[model samples]
Target: MQRLFGFMCLVLIATAVPASAQERLKVVASFSILGDFVRNVGGDRVSVTTLVGPEGDAHVYSPTPADAKKIADAKLIFINGLGFEGWLPRLVQSSGSKATVVTATTYITPLKLGSHADPHAWQTVVNAKTYINNIRVALSAAAPADAEVFKSNAEAYRAKLDALEGEIGQFIGQIPSHRRKLITNHEAFGYFAKEYGFEFIAPVGVSTEAEPSARDIAAIITQIKKAKIPAIFLENLSDPRLIKRIAAETGAKVGGTLYSDSLTDEKGDAPTYIDMVRHNIRTLRTALEGVTMRG
Candidate 1:
């Protein structure tokens, strides 16, 4: 009888442990980059659902009924904020979700171009650290039981980001100041250019939906020729036609495709946040340096 009682107690304890471990917080990230940040911090404690998947454009993203349902079911919703997701407010209201909305870019000082604020804060490594910290706080609040786990994960990830920042600085340092000018498909890289001491000229405004007028195109072409800019880059989300046209007229090379608002699918080059930054810098360096070499 004593042996049987002991065996029954051990079985009950084993079952309870697994049940407790299986309870994960449901989180919805607005896009792919924010989704990656949440996953790194949340680890086993969260189940993340991204509205905008790999290579998907958020500027013009149309949230479906299924997306609304996902938001309604989630315990937490993370967003990039700063007008990046123009459709998010309506979607949240339509879903009538009670989920706690956390803006990852809340604390960073934004850079402005004319009257609009740049929403690509994650382009700079230091701002990315702030994002991780904000995520850690939000996750800890949502799941107090797993707060330490979130903190530990964030610390590890921040260390990796520190190393990445150093690597970017060193790499960009190799390019001479005069040769650091390039053009892209859109105004997404202002934060990156400001952080890394590069000049980025774009034909379109910050939002991908904003089309460049003939005057805008003509002025950019003139600038490229007058400045003797060597490289023009095509963004992953923008139409390549405009960039190609500019490149052809200016006698500039199409440097490479840059991952701006969204990441690539799993099998592609920039599947993760860190990988995306590294790939962009390497691509820029290779194209710009190649021009310098030939000249």
Candidate 2:
């Protein structure tokens, strides 16, 4: 009889506990980069939905009606801002999403993007750490229930980012300073160039939507020859013709592919944001050092 009573008590206690105990906070990130940051900071307590998929360009992204549905139920929405997602305001309004929208670049010292602002601040490893902290604070406010989880995850992930910064700085040190001048297909590497001791010259301006003028291309090509630039690179999202022309005309070696606007597929070299940075630096090193990069 006592055994039966104890069993009944256990059953009653189990029943009294709420089934919603493990319900996670739903988050929506503007693109793959922000999605990775949110995942690092949110950990297991937040469920994130990325509107921009891998290897996709966010500059020309157009949200679908289904995306509205995804945003409507989100507890928090994270975006890189700085005019990166010009379509976001409309999407948020159309979705009637009550979620708190926060910019990851809020605390970042805004970069000069020609006449505009640079939306790719996260390219710099140091800038990325700031974005992570901003995400931590935003997520904590949006879903205070997981404040501890967000804080803990932010600290752990920030350490990894710091390590990544050190690795990149160390790796890039191998290349001679004079060989550090870079000309790429797009202006995406400005922050990277500034942070890592290189000068990134792009034929095109801030937006990928625009085209580089013939005069601009000729000038860069001339500069490449004059400066004896060892290599020129094509961005993952950019048209290859420009860089190809520069390489062919200047006789400069075309460096390995650089991850600018997006990341690689799961089975490929750059599956995540961190992987993208490592892959880019390794590619640059191999090309500049005139050696093949090892896996």
Q: Relative to the true structure, how large is the alpha-carbon lDDT of every model?
A: 0.87, 0.84
RMSD of each: 4.0, 3.8
Q: Number of clashing pairs, model 1?
A: 0
Residue-wise C-alpha lDDT for candidate 2, range 166-261, written one tens digit per residue? 889878999898888766767788889888888777643323446656776777778888878888774432567776787889987778778887
Candidate 2: stretches off by over 4 Å: 1-21, 204-223, 235-249
lDDT of 1 by residue, 7-124 (tens): 9999998787852388799999999999999999999889999999998988889999999999999999999999899999999999999999999999899999669788989988
Q: lDDT (0-100) at residue 69 of candidate 2?
A: 97
Best by lDDT: 1
lDDT of candidate 1 vs native? 0.87
Candidate with top TM-score is 1
N/CA/C clash count, model 2: 0
